[model samples]
Target: MPRFTDAFRVAEESGQTMAEYGVVLALVTLAVLAALTMLGANVSSALTGVANLLP
Candidate 1:
């Protein structure tokens, strides 16, 4: 009985850790998306400037 309880506890902890990892991954993804969005316009304009300078 004790062994079964211990197994269950460990499983629960593992599940919780996975959930935390999922949340962190989601947050990181959002941050990357936001950074890309903010930088996208600047990058586009820079490229356009370079293109204009080209023959």
Candidate 2:
């Protein structure tokens, strides 16, 4: 009855929240990976330059 519907609603809300969190986490992970991929070569080259200069 009323109590059962309330319990169900709470569960549905919690599940929705979990889905939102998962989507956000996935987006953040993608952004970070893309940034690293784009910058990886540049960073490596810079480090090599620094190393060459040190010696």
Candidate 3:
């Protein structure tokens, strides 16, 4: 029936959309992790400097 075919099509499209969202989320997570790793040492030093100035 037409309704059955439509339901299948919708499910397939939904799956594709979910896959795309998952890929984007993975890429964004990787980017954030890379940024933190690259900045970790500088951020630590900056915090230490501020702490030293306080006490």
Candidate 4:
């Protein structure tokens, strides 16, 4: 029926949107982790430097 078809279309669109959001979230998470990994060494050095500066 027409109602059933409309429901199916809506569901399909929602599923696509969900998939897109999931991909974006995964990419963002990966980017954040990569940034942290890259920055961790610098951060550790900075902390060490700060500690050395202390008494």
Q: How many residue pairs clash in each candidate?
A: 0, 0, 0, 0
The candidate 3 region of ten consecutive residues with least summed lDDT is 3-12
lDDT of 4 by residue, 1-55 (tens): 4676666555357778899999999999999999999999999999999999999
**Once superposed on the true structure, which residue ranges of model 4 sit more than 4 Å away at CA?**
1-11, 48-55
Tens digit per residue, CA lDDT, model 2, 1-41: 46766665554478788999999999999999999999999
- In model 3, the Cα lDDT at residue 36 comes to 98
Question: Relative to the unseen true structure, what is the C-alpha lDDT of residue 29 in candidate 1, on a scale of 0 to 100?
Answer: 100
The candidate scoring highest on TM-score is 3
TM-score for each of the candidates: 0.59, 0.61, 0.69, 0.59
Sorted by TM-score (best first), the order is: 3, 2, 4, 1
Q: Write the per-residue lDDT of candidate 3 for residues 1-55, one digit (tens) a residue.
A: 4676666555457778899999999999999999999999999999999999995
Candidate 2 ranges with C-alpha deviation above 4 Å:
1-11, 51-55
> Cα-based RMSD of the predictions, in order?
4.0, 3.9, 3.9, 4.1
**Residue runs of model 3 more than 4 Å from their true location after superposition:** 1-11
